[model samples]
Target: MKKGLIRTMLSAVLGLACAFAFAGEVQVAVAANFTAPVQAIAADFEKDTGNKVVASYGATGQFYAQIKNGAPFEVFLAADDTTPAKLETEGMTVPGSRFTYATGALALWSAKDGYVDANGDVLKKNGFTHLAIANPKAAPYGLAATQALDKLGLTQAVSSKIVEGQNISQAQQFVATGNAELGFVALSQIYRNGKITSGSAWIVPASLHEPIKQDAVILQKGKDNPVAKQFTDYLKGPKAAAVIKSFGYQL
Candidate 1:
C-alpha cells in the first residue's frame, strides 16, 4: 500500500511539473473601456488554465498603430469591429480567427449625484463649465459621443467647453478626479448588475449613435503562439461571457 501511494504521489507531482513547464503566455492589447472586466477575467483565466495573460490597455486606434509598427502583441481586443476588420484586410491578422467578442454601451457620467438626468438633458442645460470626451480621432467611443451630440443638436452648443483625453480611460479619470464636471464614458465603467455603481449616469441610447461592436483577433505575430488561440477561444466560452456581460457588454 505504501509503495502504491508513493507511485501515485509521484505521478501527480510530475503531471503538475509538466503543466507548468509547457504553460505559455499571451501578450494582449485590450481596449481601455474594457480594463476592469478584462482584468477580472484574466485572473480567472490564469487560475483555471495555468497560462499567463499579459495585457496592455489603451485606445484601440493607438494599439493599431503600434501593431502596424511591429509591437509584439499576440492578441487584440479592440473597441470597435472596424479596426480588427481593417487589420484582417491588410493581412496582419490570422485569417478565420476574428470575431466580435463584445458590444459596448456609452454613457454620460458625472462624479456628483443628480448631475446627469436619466434622459441626458444635462447637455442641453449646459450647466457645467467643462465636459470631458476621449479624442474622437483615436477612440471609437469618442466618435460615438460626438455622433450622439450631433443627433441631439448639442455639438455646437457644447464644443467650446470640451476637454479631450487621449483615451477613454483617461477621459473617465478626468471626470472621476473633478478635472471635468462630467464626461462621456463606457457604461461598464460606472455600472453593473442592473444599476449604476457610481455617481450618476445616463446610458446613451443605441439610436443616438452607431453600435459599439468590439472585436478580437489574433495578430500574425501570434499565429504560432498556441496560448494566443487559447485565450481567444476562452473569450468565447461561458466563463468569459459571464464576465463580459457583468460589465454591461452585450456579447
Candidate 2:
C-alpha cells in the first residue's frame, strides 16, 4: 500500500512538470489602433489558457521594420493586411499563417461638442484650424485619412493645416487633448457599444478609401511555438471576436 501511494505521487509530479513545460509565453507585436481590444483579449487569453502574452503596441510599419531587423516578437497583428503579406513574401513569417482578423474604420472626431457635423461637411467649411492624422508612411489609418481627403478634393486645401501623429492612438490624443481641434482616428478609439462615447465623430465612408483589413500572422520565430499559434487562434475565436466588435471593428 505504501509503495503504490508513492508511485501515484511520483506520477502526479511528472504530469505537472510536463504541463509546465508545455505552457509558454508569447511576445506579440500589436498595432496601436488595436489597443483596447487587444488588451481585453490578451487578458482573456491568459485566463483561459494559462499562457502569458507580452504585447508591444506601435505603428504597423514600425513593427514591420523591426521584425525585418530580427525583433523577437512571435506574433504580429498589423493595422493593414499589406504588411503581413509583404512579410510572407519576404520569408519573414510562416507561410499560410497570415489571416485578416479585423476590418477597421476611420473617423473624423473632435473633443468639443458640435464641432463636427453629421455629413462631415466641417472639412469643407474649414471650421477647424488644425486637423490631425497619423503619418501616412507609418499608419494605415493615416493612409485612409489621406485617401478620404483626396476623394473629397480637400487634400490641397487642408494640406497645410494637417498635423501628423506617429500612430492612430496619437492622432486621437491630438483631438482628445484639443491640440489639433479635430483629427482622423480609428473608430475603435472613440467608439463603444454602438455609440460614440465621447465628443463628436463622423465615421468615414468605406467608399472614401481602401478597406482597412487588419491582419495577423505567426512570425518565423514563432512557427514552431505552440503558444504563439494558440494565441493567433484565440484572436479568431468567438470570444475575441465579441471583444473586437465591441470596440467597433468588423470581423
Candidate 3:
C-alpha cells in the first residue's frame, strides 16, 4: 500500500512538471485597488502553473486608454465592468472572457484618531475643513463617493469642502499627508495587514450608491497566449478568491 501511494504521488509530481514546461508568461493590467490581492494571486498562479505573470496596476480609465492605444497587456482586471464590456464591444477583449470577480466598497477614513466617526455623521458636522475624494470622472471610488454624498444630501453642501485627487491612491495620500483631514478611499487601503489600522472608518453601505462590480477579462493582445488563459483560469479559482477576501474586499 505504501509503495502504491508513493507511485501515485510521483506521478502527480511528473504531471505538474509537464504542465509547467508548457506554460509561458502573461502580462496583466489590474486596477490599483485590487493590487495587493492580485499580486498574491499571481504568485500562487505561477507556482501552480509554472507561468510568469507581469502585472501593472492603475486607474481603470487610464488602462482603458492604454488598451485602446494598443498596450501590450494580456489581461485586464478593472474596478468597473463598463470598461471591460466596452472593450468587448469594441473587439478589444475576448468575448465570453469577461467575469465579475469582486465588488468594491468605499470608506471614509482619517489618519488622525477620532477624526472620523463610526457612522460617518462627521461629514454633516462640518468639523472638517477639507474632504478628499478621487477625480469622479476617472475613478470608480470617486464615483462611489460622489454617489454616497448625493444620497446623503451632502453633494452640493460639501462641494466647497472637497479636495479631489487623481486616483484612489492619491486620495489616500492626501489624507495620509494631512492635505485633507478625511478622505474617501477604497476599503483595501485602510484595512491592511489583515486588519484596519490607521484610523476610524465607516464602510459606505452598498445600498447608498451604485455597485462597484470589478471585472476581469483576457485582452485581445493575449488572444492566443496559453499563459494568459491559464492565469485567467487560476484567477477564477479558490486560492485567488481567498487572497482577495483577505485584502478586506468582497469577493
Candidate 4:
C-alpha cells in the first residue's frame, strides 16, 4: 500500500512539471508609437492561443541598442524596417522571420478644436506659436515630420517654434496637455477606442514623406520558442489586422 501511494504522488509531480515546461511566454520589444494597437492585438492573441506576450515599448534607437548589446527580447516590433533588417544581417534575429507589420502615419494634432485645418493648410500659415516634434535621429515619426516640413517648404520658417520630444508619445503628450499649441504625433493616438478623439489632426500625405513601414522579427534568443512563432503568426491574422487598422495603422 505504501509503495503504490508513492508511485501515484511521483506521477502527479511529473505531470505538473511537464505542463509547466510546455507553457511559454514570448517577450516583445515594441516601438512607442505602436503601443495601443499592439496591446489590443496581444490581448486577442492571448485569447486565441494559450501563449502569453510580455511587451516593452521604447524608441527604435533604444531597442536597437539593447538588442545589439544582447537584450533578451524574443521579438522586435520596430518603428521602421531598417533596425530589424540590420539585426537579421548581424545574426541577432532569425532569418526569414522579418516582415512589415504596419505602416505608420505622421500627423499634426491639437487637443483643442479648429487648431488644425482639415487639409493641413495651417502648416503653411505658421498658425501655431509652438509645435512639438520627436527627435528625427531617434524616432521614425520625427523623421517623417521633418520630411513633411521639407516637402511643404516650412522647415526653415518653422524651425524656431519647434520643440523636440525624445519619442512620438512625448510629442503627443506635449500637444495633449497644452504644453505646445500643436505637435506632430502618431495617427494611432487620435483614434483610440475605435473612434477618433476630440483632437483635430491632419494625416501627413505619403507623398510628403518616406513610408513608415514598421517591421517585426523573432530574435535569436527566441528562435526555438514555440510561443514566439505563435505570437508572430497571430499578429498576421485577420483579427489582429483589424485591431491594427482601427488604430490608424495600415497593415
Candidate 5:
C-alpha cells in the first residue's frame, strides 16, 4: 500500500510538471474598440487552457507602426481587415494567418438624453456646437464616420465644428465628458446587454459606410508560438464569439 501511494504522488507531481512545462504567455495587440470583449475572452482562455495573455490596446494604425518597428506582440487584433492584410503582404505576419474576427458597427452618440434622434437627423439639424470623431487617418471607426458624413453631405458643413480624438475610446470620452456635444464611436463602447446604457445614440446603417471587418493575425515573431495559435483559434470558438456579440460586434 505504501508503494502504491508513493507512485500516485509521483504521478501527480509529474502531471503538474507537465502542465507547467506546456504553459506559456501570448502577447497580444488589440484594437481599442475590442478592449472589453478581448479582455473577457482572454480571461476565459486563460481559465480553460492554463495559458496567459498579455494584451495591449490601442489604435490599429499605431499598432501597425509599432509592429513594423519590431514590437514584440505575438498576435494582433486590428480594427480593420485592411491593416492585417497589409501586414501579411509586408511579411510582418504569417502568410494566410489573417481572418475576420468581427464586423464592428458605428454609432453617433451623445452623453445627454434627447440629443440624437432615431433617424440620426442630429447631423443635419446642426444643433450641437461641437462634433467629435476619431482621427480619420488613425482609426477605422473614424474613417467610417467620415464616410458616413460624406454620404450625408455633412462633411463640409460640420468641418469647422469637428473635434478629433486619438481613437474611438477617446472620441466616446469626448462626448461622455462634454468635450464635444456628440461623436462617432464604436457601438461596443456604448452598448451592453442589448441596450444603450446611457445617453442617446443612432446606430449608423451599414449602407452608410464600408463594412468594418476587424481581423486578427499571428505576427512573424509568433509564427511558432503554440499559445499564440491557440488564442487565435479560441477567438473563433463559440465562447469568444458569444462574448464578442455581447459587445455589439457582429461576427
Candidate 6:
C-alpha cells in the first residue's frame, strides 16, 4: 500500500510538472477594490493551473478607456457590472464570457481607532475636516458613497469637505496617511473574516446605495488565449470564492 501511494504521489508531481512546462501569462485589468483578494486568488490559481497572472489595478472607468483603446489586458475584472456590459456592447469582450464575480460593500473608515461609530453617526456630526472618496465619475464605490450621503441628507454638508481619489486604493490611502480624518472606502479594503481588519469602520447599509455587482470577462484581446478563459473559470471556483468572502466581498 505504501509503494502504491508513493507512485500516485509521484505521478501527480509529474503531471503538475508537465502543466508548468506549458505555462503562459495572462494580463488582467483588475478594479482597485479587489486588489487583496485577487492577489490571494492569483497565487492559488498559479499553483493549481501553472498560469502566471499579470494584473493591473485601477478604476473601472479608467480600465474601460484603456481597454477601448486597445490595452494589452486580456481579462477585465470591473468594479461594476455595467462597465463589463458596456464593454460587451462595444464589442471589446469575448461573447458569452462575462459574469458577475463578486458583490461589493462600502464603509466609512478612519485610520484612528474608535473614531467611527458602529452606526456611522459621525458623518452627521460633521466633526471631521476632510473626507476622502474615490472619484464618482470614474469609480462605482464613489457613486455609492455619494448616494449614501444623499440618503442621509448630508450631501451638501459633505461636499465641501470631500477629497477625491483616482481610485479606491488611493481613497483608502488618504485615510491611512492622515490626509483625511475619515472617508468612504470599499469594505473589502479593511475587512476580513467577518470583522474589520484595522482602525475603525461602519459597514454602510446596502439600502442606501445601488448594488455593486462586480463582473469579470475575457476581453477581445484574449479571444484566442486559453489562459484568459482558464483564469476567469478559476475565479468562479470555490477556492476563489473563499478568498473573495474573506475580504468582505459577497459571491
Model 4 TM-score relative to the real fold: 0.89
For each candidate, what is the lDDT?
0.95, 0.94, 0.88, 0.88, 0.93, 0.95
- Lowest-scoring 10 consecutive residues by lDDT in candidate 5? 14-23
Question: What is candidate 3's lDDT per residue for 104-144, written digit by digit as tens?
Answer: 88999999988788799999987888999988887888999
Off by over 4 Å in 6: 1-16
Which residue pairs in candidate 3 have backbone atoms (N, alpha carbon, C) closer than 3 angstroms, thus clashing? none
* Candidate 6 residue lDDT tens string, 1-251: 99999999999999988888999989999999999999999999988888999999999999999988889999999999999999999888999999999999999999999999999999999989999999998999999999999999999998899999999999999999999999999999999899998899999999999999999999999999999999999999999999999998888
lDDT of 4 by residue, 97-132 (tens): 999989988888889888798888887888678999
C-alpha displacement of 56 in model 6, angstroms?
0.3
Ranking of predictions according to lDDT: 6, 1, 2, 5, 4, 3
Measured by TM-score, the strongest candidate is 1
Between candidates 2 and 6, which one is better according to TM-score? 6
Q: Estimate each model's TM-score.
A: 0.97, 0.92, 0.89, 0.89, 0.93, 0.94
| Pairs clashing within candidate 2 | none
Best by lDDT: 6
Give the per-residue lDDT digits (tens) of candidate 5, residues 1-251. Answer: 99999999999999988987888999999999999989899999988888999999889999999999989999999999999999998889988789999999999999999899999999999988999999889899999999999999999999999999888888888999998989999999989879998999999999999999999999999998999999999999999999999989998
RMSD of each: 1.1, 3.3, 3.3, 4.7, 2.2, 2.2
The segments of candidate 5 whose C-alpha lies over 4 angstroms from its true place after superposition are 1-22
Instruction: For residue 55, give model 3's deviation from the true position in Å.
Output: 1.3
lDDT of 1 at 217: 99
Q: Which TM-score value belongs to model 3?
A: 0.89
lDDT of 2 by residue, 79-188 (tens): 99999999999999988989999999999999988888899999999867899999999999999999999999999999999999999889989899889999999999
